[model samples]
Target: MQSFDPKLDRRRFLIAGAAAAVAVPAIAQDGLIDEPAAGTDPDVVHNISSFRARDWRPHFSSLSGGAILVDTGSRALHFWSSDSSTYRLYPTSVPVSEELTRRGRTEVVRKVVGPSWAPTPSMKKRNPEWPDFVPPGPNNPLGTHALYLGWQYYRIHGTHDTRKIGRPSSNGCIGLYNEHIAQLYELVSPGCQVLLI
Candidate 1:
């Protein structure tokens, strides 16, 4: 089995994009690094703000069947293996506004590779110009993999748009890098526990 290390992998990911990186100082007590208020230019969104490793105990009773804790404020996801061995931390894109965010526990109800996409009813109502459906491909918003949550229209999925990572960009779902989500897809199973906070 391939091992995962949050520190080492995070360093590698940062080094690969060092040219475009900005200084990241620690932020407020809430654990979320403050960013420019909502509605700022998407291009200006920071690739990563606060990336921190967390103990799964506070969020989960145990790691049986594995556990995933998504810190929406920090724009990061933490995963722990069922045996409490492997752990991974990945920067993620969160819901754009408080109204779009959902907190509490859910389980991965399904896992799909090369998943298709369709905007939710709320999404369509807000933006009627979007297509009714999009086949699995480069243009699909769900990217290469998706972990369908117990909640309707919610997923922990990947995005082709790298700029969305570490920013509040998704309509409601949590977004990860295509590569990260692909790796996560391999490690997680359908009944894996998930918490969004």
Candidate 2:
């Protein structure tokens, strides 16, 4: 895991699927999703070596595509592909979880894509080179895509800083690689169920 970098505060990270509220300037490039992208690791995405076991409704429960569970404390994301492909990539400093439970399980929420990466004033204050908006790319810093967790800005996504793939990095954004984010992109959406066990 990568140590936390103040530049990319997870709290200010963008909320995906919603547009027109805040459009940061950007230099457009080919918005293409390459296969290799799905394979490369992203800085914002955390990883786990093994998974336990669980049972639940499929992620395709109508409007509920299931959920992605994340255990930030565990430094891993469990892809419960069975019950909505749960993802468990925990953020470092998540406040006391206020979420309720069902059948002794955490409630799953919607999945997201290309989650926005809105920088903090401190980020700009520290790094003047930081741009208001960074388009999606290997250097964009927000990685490629983010899996927004529940209501908070917390998420799991690709990273601008991937050197810390297996280490803790960012204010809270889980880091993977550009290619990895793209790969996850092909399988998930904003409504997929997730459990942060």
Q: How do the residues 1-197 of candidate 2 rate in per-residue lDDT, one tens digit apiece?
A: 98786656543454432343444222112222222236644322321332222223332243255445444555444444434434433222221223321111233244445555667675577678877876655556666676665545456577756565655555545556667666665666655555544
Off by over 4 Å in 2: 1-64, 82-116, 121-129
Looking at model 1, the pairs that clash are none
Q: How many residue pairs collide in each prediction? A: 0, 46
Worst 10 residues of 2 by lDDT: 25-34
Q: Across residues 69-185, which tens digit of lDDT does each residue of candidate 1 receive?
A: 998988889899999989998999999999999999999999999999999999999999999999999999999999999999999999999999989999999999999999999
Winning candidate number (lDDT): 1
Compared with the true structure, all predictions reach lDDT values of 0.89, 0.48
- Cand. 2 Cα-lDDT: 0.48
Worst 10 residues of 1 by lDDT: 22-31
Each candidate structure's TM-score, on Cα atoms with residue i matched to residue i, is 0.76, 0.47
Error of 1 at 41 (Å): 34
